[model samples]
Target: RLAGSAAGWGFQFQSPGFVVAVCWLLFLMGLNLLGVFEVSAGRLGQVQTGSGRGGDMMTGLLAVIVATPCTAPFMGVAIAGALGGSPVMGVLVFLSMGLGLAFPYILVAGVPGVASRMPKPGAWMGILKQVLAFPLFATCVWLLWVAAIQRGVTFVALTAGGVVLLGFAGWIYGVGQRRSMLEGGRGTVAFCRVVAALCVVICGAALAQGLRAAPAPVVAGAVEAGVEPFSEARLAELRAQGKPVFIDMTASWCITCMVNERVALDVPSVQEAFRSRGIVFLKGDWTNRNAAIAEFLKAHGRDGVPFYMYYAPHQDGVVLPQILTPGIVISTIGK
Candidate 1:
């Protein structure tokens, strides 16, 4: 869906942090398979339990989200083509990508013989569970890196610490579970469920708040002090004045876009080149998913962002590459 929208609507594809998160997840899963960590059968052992179901569902969701950051080589061309086509066409392309991702999991889970051949619940399971925690730890590290890019190291540390504490609490709870607790009365089980739900809700809220409080990243070398974002009307007016305009359409969730701005766009030479060429720089914020921006993307055949469009005086508009380079920008403007 994202790739299709990006191509059709000219949105940029920026997802390095996502890529790291996915790689870490795969690494952790691999470690579990290799018997690096053990899974435990405890009071919360029943796969049918609400908590177990919730955990499994959450894991599945995280897998999907993490996988989205890195486009496999085979998927790149299809995604690019979707972004440059009609909305329906773009959506179809995304659907194909989704199917490709889900197929392996479905096959593994559906085949009864294959599922039975998998390691039975045992001591190794406990070790596998502990090893799985390492991936979550790695994920925290990656999130911290991304947070450091936007906010400071302090905020990153705080967020990472909080996430670690949450994990530690979960580990303690899991390890403390006794067989007696599993055989306890219905009332006792109900109470435990309530407590677990409350804890999960609290942890979720804290994480959301931490992410919200993180500061916006500053585009390096750009004098952002009082430069207001450009409206569509303002862009049209500038075009009327025969000035070249560079539009950066981005969102807070876009890690790749942020990196591009800080590392490439913010370079002194890039900034100077834009200024010297009398280029009007405009930033279109898509943090909250504005309807106008959505329409803008749909017009270009996109459904999501990190989109970049360049309009030059007396020339055809140019769609910038998804992966940015200083030379790409300089050359585009120079033309």
Candidate 2:
């Protein structure tokens, strides 16, 4: 809501604090899924009473948190269009997308026969829940990789320690819940809760200390055969010389961007085509926030990374599809 309004609060992708926060959130969620501890509403005790609404709300929240960083090929156009238009349009577009995502579950739930055919609760469900935890764990690993790229090794080390603390907190909390159920002792439960809270606090303190320290210097990577760092001045210089240029705006955290690079941009044939065609490749690293790159994306009617633009000499820049194949790149450059 804030993003669409005049407030225009743009998100900084790969921010150290944001990345660590998400990492911890996912790590804790994975622990929950693994049965370390169940989340409680405390005040809204109804949630724990199996009304089903709480689970639905949690599913929706998890989906939004994990999916926000992604700009899928199919939805890229719709998202860009929404962001470029009035706030009303943005809200409507997002709501429509949400409906699209939820439609499958809604259908199954609404259809009596479909619901009847679903399997009844059993021990298999417990096994399945534990299985699902792995994916969340994998996602945490990926986020840590993003943190390493942006903030370097020190950040990752501190974040890893925080993960340990979180796991310990979850464990202690689970022990408290079990004891409270078995022995029904209030004092014991209160002591366990206090210890768990302290662990979490210490974890937060460690993360804060890590963030206060300056990040390790980013070592310059070896330049690829035909690629150069992207900048507005360089783009203009190439255009003035009437040279064809291909701009790759990407980020380390963008899975689609990474896939496209491996499958399309880095393919031998694509590299050969660039060499033969005398095309200049400018690679923009949006792994960390860059205002210039953000402005370029906005100018091109996009609000996220994985943006690709091809500028032919004497012609306007052409935006390529979000999902690319080697054939797509070769053919685009061939033109």
Candidate 3:
């Protein structure tokens, strides 16, 4: 179910953060397996005598993350069918993929002896816990790299250093009997956690806003084009212009759509064609959830973004291919 949500929400394995997150999680699991760290499961710690089923679940989740990019043989067809089908069908396709990935673990967990054969809890778990810290450290590095790509190197470096320092401070507090650190007890820890969470929220919001505010890239030899969110009245007006209307139904989360916009759509030749031919460029932003856009998608038999449609003057809309090329856009507009 989570896998489906992730995929639907444009969180693909190809995404840098997704890759880093999976690797970091796996590293943490391996550490647990080696008995370096012990995660408490409330009062049930005694009954749960194994490397840690929670860690295993984490492993399973990582497995899904890694597998998402490889689009299985029939997966592409399934996704296409689902997108063009009903909303229920779209959801079912995502659910099916999740179940397929989770099947192995589900089968193993269901077996009687499989769970019992797991290693019993032991003292060596502490060693495993320490070793697992390295993976967490590695994950921090990966996240920094992703942040650098999306935002900038300086922001990522500072954030990474801050996290490392915080982790070190926490470790020191755990090890030492310093009066200032120990006296506050749960209150201090809880307060610190809240502060950290708030910092994260602020940083994320700032980053998103910064990215949004950044200037759109310029494509030379092409007239400056603007795309507004879709509206029925606007479509009718464009149709009245007696020119081809290239309707781009996209969301902020759609990587393929972004790629096309950055490459094909922004290319000089593509832009020139649109300009000379008087092609009306229409963009439907579906970044946030919108019932109007949802209805628009349903009416057109599509369930997701990167849904390209070419409307010939006074004719029905023609759905364009998902994977776009400059020639495709030009040719469609010329027709």
Among the numbered candidates, top lDDT falls to: 2
- Off-target runs (Cα >4 Å) in candidate 2 are 1-12, 40-55, 219-225
lDDT of 3 by residue, 26-87 (tens): 44344444433333333133345444665555555655554433343225457657655678
Q: On a 0 to 100 scale, what is the lDDT of residue 5 in model 1? A: 36
For residues 58-159, write the lDDT of model 1, one tens digit per residue: 565665565443332234457557766678987898787667777877887889988887778888776766666666656545555544544556555555
Candidate topping TM-score: 2
Residues 1-335 of candidate 2 have per-residue lDDT tens digits of 45442211124445778778888988887888798888733323455656767766666766765676674556777878787788899899988988988988998889999888899999999999889889989988998888888778878888998999889999989889899999998898998899989998898888888888988865222246678999999999999999999999887777888899999999889999988989999988877767788788888778777889999998999889989999999889888
Select the stronger candidate by TM-score from 1 and 2.
2
Candidate 3 vs. true structure, TM-score? 0.51
What TM-scores do the predictions have? 0.58, 0.90, 0.51
Clashing pairs in 3: 35-125, 35-128, 35-129, 36-127, 36-128, 36-129, 37-129
Quantify all predictions' global Cα lDDT against the true fold. 0.59, 0.81, 0.58
Clashes of each: 26, 0, 7
